[model samples]
Target: MRVLVCDDEQLARDRLKRLVEKADNVEVVAEAANGREAIEQTQEHRPDVVLMDIRMPEMDGMEAAEHLSKIDNPPAIIFCTAYDEHALQAFKVHAVDYLLKPVSLSDLEMALSKARTLNRVQLAELGKEVSEEKPRRRGHISARTHRGLELVPVDEVRYFLADQKYVTVCFSEGEVLIDETLKDLETEFGEQFVRIHRNALVALRYIEGMELATAGHHQVRLRGIEERLTVSRRHVAGLRKVLQSL
Candidate 1:
């Protein structure tokens, strides 16, 4: 069984790596310092199980596990934390097991055995439960590409353009296709992004200004990119007000 260990503390990760190495037939695939790295490592390694820490900076373990659950053949999660308060929340996300801090080798092995038995259907069910709850406003958005899963930091994203069923995420570096609806994106990132058109959402921080494109039509100019997006008639007034405030 392949395993990834994630913890904020380097010592904790080292200890877990040692314990994981001792487990029969289990290899320590990778180690992550926080939840974002955990997700990236999981994407790269495709581990069968993840030993996660709950309280982490940037992104927490629960949020990372929720994101991972949406992927194909998701690895089973086993949360390891010092606080017992997070146990209920851990089980709510359908963790394979929850081990308290200073985890024992025997307990970890049992959890790994349980993780190995989790079928796709079980992981699917967990994903559904996570989706039913209020969608988390993430610091980063994930996209599945031929290379693998790509993570785009929300702060760096300039805009989201919806073309039929797919949403194109324009970031500082480049753009990537994501499997998210514009309406859902609007709902999740309403504070940071504004609906400029029916098919587009522009980041408030990236908005340079609005210009008249043609007779009675206007387009928004973004800071990082030259491509100007058409702003709908209904949203023109609101967008102008947003720009004024900025």
Candidate 2:
């Protein structure tokens, strides 16, 4: 079994590496100092399991695990933390097990052996619901492209158009289909984007002007995108006000 060890402390990571070496059939594939790096390494290495540290800087293990869970196949997670209280709470999500800091070799082996599959996506959802602190809003989304995970900066995003289950994320480079809902995108990026229609949330930066469409209909013309989004009757006034402010 391949494993990626993630911890902020160098000593902690080194100790875990030495201990992991003793376990039969287990190979340490990568090491990450923080949750963001952990997510990147997991994608690059495709490790079977991640020894995740909960209290990490930039992105906590819970949030990183949540993002990683969005992929086609996420690794089983075994949370390794200094806190014991987390054991009671963390299992509710997708984590296969939690190991207290200064983990015994036997416990590590047992945890690895017991893991049939990584924690479920529901586990990550539960983490979001419980925490008092919301996960840091990502400046870029990891959009899966034909080239793999493409990090699309939020600043470059032109608009998000909803079509049934998927939302097409239009950026400066191009557009990509994502599984995210329009409502969720609105909540997350409300400051940057405003609702122009029931089906669309457009970036304020991309709004060049509005033009009158056929028979009293209104359309928003974005800077670079060729598509002219129809402005819903209910939202036209609000869109005008937002544009007027800028």
Candidate 3:
């Protein structure tokens, strides 16, 4: 099996490479120093399995795995982290197996043999669990592009529109669809954005003013965006209260 090693430390990467070389039926195909490079190498080499470190400089394993899950026929992911076993129960809940740091050869073989491919739903769940545990929300949002993963800084995003299961993030450059719920996003970015409608969250910084859509309905006008989103009757009251506060 082709395997990719992703860790921030050079020593960790070297040790993982040696162990993977000794393992039967597995070869070290690529190595990455951070989660961003992991995504790049994973795309280039198309390894059968990826040994991902949970914490890294640019991105973490959970975020990388979320991006990797979008790839067509994505590789199996085995998170290798120094996090305590009990703390990693969330990963196990979603059926994504993990190995503790200082990985044992036997554990590596077993993880490779039983590594399960993560579907979009499971990946979404994994992201949710990670978000719930994090003390601060992620500074950037990741979306799948035609080439690879795209990172949109939370500050650059102007608004978010919910479409069924996906949230379309409208940013300074353009918009990209992501597998995150509107409610979850509102909770995470509540300080920066306000819920304008049940299906949309508008950034407070972009708010120009409100316009009347019809007799009683209202619409919010953003700075650069010409198109305005409807303010549902149910949400109008809360939106007014928020606007007054602002």
Candidate 4:
């Protein structure tokens, strides 16, 4: 099996590479220093499995796994971290296994044996777990594009517009389509965003003001974008209360 080694520290990567090489029929395909590189290398190399570290600069493994899960025929994820606390979160993202630091060759080999692509049902179940766990909000949001996985800083997001089955994340530069539900997005980012309508959530910090858009209808003006989103009458009072505290 082809494997990608991802860890911030050189020593950790080296050790993982050595152990991976020891496994029967397994070869070290590439190495990545952080979660961002991990995703890039995975896209370029098409590794069968990734030995992922949970904590790293730029992006954490959990967030990286979320992005990887979107790719076509995503590589199996096996989290290798020093901390034990993230084990649940690791499995929540559908990792093949969780291996702690100072990993043993036997454990690594056993984990490698379990590598397999996740099915749509498993991915759907993971989404449900993510929403239910209310995992710590990530700093950036990831979307798969033709070029590969793109990371959009959560702070740059102007708003989230939900259609039937997809949510469009509008950030400072542009917009990207994502599979997350609006309700799940609101639940995870409630502090930073507010629901303006059943179909939309606007960034609290980006709200320029509110005004009447048409007869008996209201719209919200956001700072970075020209388009004005309609504010549902039912949510207007709640939006006002949230805005007042901000």
Candidate 5:
């Protein structure tokens, strides 16, 4: 199985790589010096497993893992960290296993064994869900619009605009305002959505591409949809990353 090792320290990374090599079925395919690199490598390599460090420059492993978990066919993650305090959060994000630093070969092997088993189960479950949901295409977004609750279906939807208090579900049929913020929708419908701004969430399949506009701004072009959605500067990097993965 292909594996990616991520650690800020060169010694730790090399140690993990050697340990992975000792395993019968596992191979260390790539290494990262930080969480940001880990995320980039994850997109580029698509490894079956990631040995992630908990803390690093640019981004923390927990945050990167959280984002990585949203990707389609995400690798089974095995967090390799020195801190034991983060074990609970690691498991909360559905990590396959956690190995403390100065990792033992036996422990690494055990984690690898568990990761292989868990990855199989995860892939199977993902396939089943995708087949079962048949995820609605260009369907209505349930939200509060005008003065009351409203449902804005695909044909009518112009775009989804996010504000601090709510997400305005704009459609040709008329806009429906939802009380829930973009973050709420992100957690609820992450599979069908892409984040363009910290406050904004756009349907993934609807996004055609991104346009570089004047004044260092970027706009998202939606497929079968004319309205352009604004991409926040902070989220532009993440948007670009996700697009590249697709």
Candidate 6:
């Protein structure tokens, strides 16, 4: 199996490369020094598997994996990191396996076996052409309003504001405060919404444009909505890119 090894440390990459070469069925096809390079290499080499390091400069492995997994024919990812804290999150993203640092040849073999099995399963699923089905629109967003347990539809939503604990779903007709977090909503309705801040996720269709305000702050102007949304500095570039693509 073709494999790509990614790590910020040159020594770590070299060590992993030797270990991968020692594997009977594994071929070390390429190597990357960071997450950005890993993405680029994955596109170019189309390796069957990638040995990813969790933390790196420019982009973290989790973020890179999220983007890479969305590619047409993404390689199976096997996270090789020293930190064990991210094992659960790694598995949540459908990683083949998580191998701790100083990974033994036996551990590498086990990960490889799992990756091959997963690749076969994914290919089989892809071979069967599933009929295109329309996704059902959310009829109501369960929220705590004055009446409690209020159901709000898509049209009624103006924008979603994120607070410390809860996300306030504002509507033209009436606002409803939901107990859900912004990250949870992002996963549920990523196609219909855009994350304008780490704390906020807003409906894409309602966004009119963004304006540069004082102190280099950015504000999102929503169509038919009176409240202007704040865009965090980290998300400004991404929001601008999404708007330009629209």
Q: Pick the candidate with the highest lDDT.
A: 1
Give a tens-digit lDDT track for model 1, residues 1-246. Answer: 989999999999999999999989999989999998998899889998999999999888988887787677888899999999998888888788999989999999899888878887887787767755634677888787776767788999999999988999999889899877898889999999999999999999888899998787999899979899999999999998988888
Sort the candidates on lDDT, descending order.
Answer: 1, 4, 2, 3, 6, 5
lDDT (10s digit) by residue, model 5, range 51-70? 99988876667756654554
Q: Which residue window of length 10 is worst by lDDT in model 4?
A: 123-132
Error of 2 at 156 (Å): 4.4
Q: Give each model's whole-structure lDDT.
A: 0.89, 0.81, 0.79, 0.86, 0.73, 0.76
Q: Number of backbone collisions per candidate, in order?
A: 0, 5, 0, 0, 5, 0
RMSD of each candidate relative to the true structure: 2.2, 4.6, 4.4, 2.8, 14.7, 15.1
Each model's TM-score, in the order given?
0.89, 0.73, 0.74, 0.87, 0.54, 0.54
**Which prediction has more favorable TM-score, 2 or 5?**
2
Index of the highest-TM-score prediction: 1
lDDT of 4 by residue, 1-246 (tens): 789999999999999998987889999999999988998899999898889999899898998887777677677889999999998878877788999989999998888876644554665565455435545787788787787778898999999999999999999999999878898888889889999999999999999888877788899999978999999999999888887887
lDDT of 5 at 65: 66
Model 2, 158-230: lDDT tens digits are 9999999988998988889887788878887899999998899999988999989999999999999788999
> What would the per-residue lDDT of candidate 3 be over residues 207-231, giving only the tens digit for each residue?
8878788788899998887888888
lDDT of 6 by residue, 173-233 (tens): 7676766667666766788889887777888888999999899899999887777889999
Please give the lDDT score at residue 43 for candidate 3.
86
CA displacement after TM-score superposition, residue 199 of candidate 3 (Å): 2.7
Pairs in clash, predicted candidate 3 = none
Q: Compute the lDDT for candidate 4.
A: 0.86
